[model samples]
Target chain A: MRFTSESSADGIVTRDFTLDGIPGVLWSPAAGPSRAPLVLMGHGGGNHKHSPAMSGRAALLVRGGGFHVAVIDAPGHGDRPRTAHDEQEIAALYAARAAGRPEGPIVVRYNAHLAEQAVPEHRAVLDALQRLPEIGADGPVGYFGLNMGTAIGVPLVAADPRFTAAVFGLHWPDALAGHARRITVPVQFAMQWDDEHIPREAALALFDAFASKDKTLHANAGRHKELPRFEANDAVPFFVRHLGSAIPGASPALT
Target chain B: MRFTSESSADGIVTRDFTLDGIPGVLWSPAAGPSRAPLVLMGHGGGNHKHSPAMSGRAALLVRGGGFHVAVIDAPGHGDRPRTAHDEQEIAALYAARAAGRPEGPIVVRYNAHLAEQAVPEHRAVLDALQRLPEIGADGPVGYFGLNMGTAIGVPLVAADPRFTAAVFGLHWPDALAGHARRITVPVQFAMQWDDEHIPREAALALFDAFASKDKTLHANAGRHKELPRFEANDAVPFFVRHLGSAIPGASPALT
Candidate 1:
């Protein structure tokens, strides 16, 4: 489940690759051929390759922290096409949820439908990482997610134990409440102090319930978008300590 | 021609008016009507209300510094159409100047074109400011600019001399080389140490050439985009000192 990447101290090079016939983007710093650690970054809802948060983080990792970063679009996001449920159907689904019309089978079906659309794309990105020439067979890998990515990425880490560390920002407990026991890797949870969307207490409890050997909680003074500043400074060091040496291309010094 | 504007410590119910016509966006802590000292903000190139730099500066002014900030777009930029020459024609004009073609008539024509297209809109914004009921006749006013705004704002300050103080980031000396004598108000010139578009030495020379009775030069450690971090701590204090008390609706206490 773990993968290696290659990078250098100056700047990272982003190369396009196809995974399981699905196109994806890979990032690594410009360095002599050398194995380096990798961090898999997942974007938030309705985001794609050019999302500011993801691109900013990737730039920070390459220039500030000197880490190799990879990013991909999720299903029904980015350039992907809409599923059987277009905007109207999706609105109806949410309306149904809001109106307290409990259709258990329908909820399950919708969840499965989303997963069916997304999991393949996720696997494609992961599989492409394994096939990268520079990543090698034994390099360390980490996962970082924001919002919806937290929901999708946690299960990916659980299914594959090779992910040595993870960081989740602005995540609620219910997204992965039942799967906490499955995540054995070191994890860090970053939350906003006054987030309107996610209840702060519930988010803390979810991080606390995780059965990882090592877990840490962090908070920022600002709301959801501003949380990245704390991560820019804190998360890089945590990844370096847990995942391995700073990835040559992943260091912040380059930025 | 120095103008002053004052509001309560809460920064609501501003008192100074210089230009007339534009309505200020008002916010107060209390439910009732209030006013504060006005902070006039000018945006850079090709930006409008949705611009991140303008919005970020406005947010920082409101949240970090506790000030009432107003941002307006300039002419031929942001919600304004280009009624004049396209890029090729503009390039030809520059080429004509470089080739020492007839300069006086071309300069006059160019200025006339801009005056017709850009100046009226800017004057309209200023005119709007002159009519705010909360702003006093002699209340303090602070002006700040970035990039192209810096280019245009210098002439405005020179001609009007109403701004109590101002901050200019990323200025071009060639554009304002002749107007230094007109700038008698206290001013701060912030130049990036590593700005690629504008050389640091030239910026310093421009600041030195200014005729302000009181002025300070701040050297930030970042490029043009990162200048906000330098202002993160000092901007509020500088504005408060020059622009009088904070407004009631957008006070620092909210942060």
Candidate 2:
């Protein structure tokens, strides 16, 4: 998708817009009159559009590959109002649920319910992307999500089938597997061995379930926060293989 | 040296001052109503107050140890003006003095001159610190410099013996040794294995020249940019031992 060339001298432009009726911030690089492929990115839980992880990746893609990227605040993050009580109250609620609980069915049920409530907000963001003028209809479109974003994005891509390629970093297998069978586009999955939230087995299983014509999985060396920068070095090739023509200086390997 | 409790929250205040009569920015964190320990921090080449490497260390000291910290601009860097036309001009001028083959003699002469020009700026900052009412007469003072800061600070600290402790990260041994023997305060030296600027042997020789009754050396696992944060985690204890009480919950091994 081609972005308009009105970005600041630093090649970045910041704007506020409504996506599926949810207000959020968008950051895109200046691409002049030329059209560039668009990559829709989602941040991890409790992170906002200006999150270091998201902004860092945006910088790499903009400077390293000249791709137009956009990131939106997820529900209850950034400017979004918290639908629940204050942070302390929420922490206490979660603490109580974990107190004396075994690590099995009960915890799984509670998490599943939370995940269900979050899906619609994520879908809204994806749907809103379809309406943005900056995102051209004729070019390749990619989606990238990490952790919580991955949870929402995998299912959204599975249910919608419009994305040309998708990459999920440090995510769970069960949630991803359910949607993986439905993805027809190229998919890249990164599994972090030291992740605190997701198990390695589940990550591997999700990678195994992807029935996409082209799929790649990388077992990385750091914790979740360090994975994005690590994957950026690996992602250039993946993007070039599937969306090479749409991105400037796209290469088969990270230089 | 006890600073007033109120002053620590207000930050260190400075009087109007000039370096070579050139206006400069000066700042100090209010250590407290009672006298508290102080640290003089020097930024790396091409770096200033807001540089991530410098600011991150300041944050750690303030948040992790509650120490008062001060940082200053050096000659030809940040707010400081170049004595020569430009970097290339300066290099060329030095090159000509060394018979068009600028080698060790040329570099030593060039940096030594730069160090001379920077002394007054460093002193002006120290003068401002001494005038702070909150910093009382008894609180200990320390000095730490990173990269180029070490080049200038080693001479600055050695020539003036008021500091109670000093630390250098990424330093040139032969150049620094001129002042290293004069440092009576407890000293700490940290070096990165892969430092591109200061070779390992030079750093080691510099560390060995210190005649302080108490000395410590830390060989870290990363490059120059990563060394500060890693050393900051350990340097606090060194400061606590020679300066005052350890920061609460800080490990004793840090010293």
Weakest lDDT window of 10 consecutive positions for candidate 1 chain A: A1-10
Candidate 2 per-residue C-alpha lDDT over A3-28 given as tens digits, one digit per residue, 9 for 90 to 100: 22333557766665665445554566
lDDT of 1 by residue, A1-255 (tens): 232333333366766554544445666767634666778887776577557777667766554445678877666667667676745446665787688764333433443455445655675566667666767556778888867667677667777756878887566665466666688787777666556556656665676566775565554334555553435444565676676655445422211
Every prediction's TM-score for the first chain? Answer: 0.79, 0.78
Model 1 spans > 4 angstroms off: A1-10, A86-117, A222-228, A246-255, B1-255
Model 2 C-alpha lDDT per residue in residues B142-183, reported as the tens digit of each score:
887866778887898888767888877576766779788887
Q: Candidate 2, overall lDDT?
A: 0.62
Stretches off by above 4 angstroms in model 2 are: A1-9, A85-128, A222-228, A245-255, B1-255
* lDDT score for residue A132 of model 1: 64
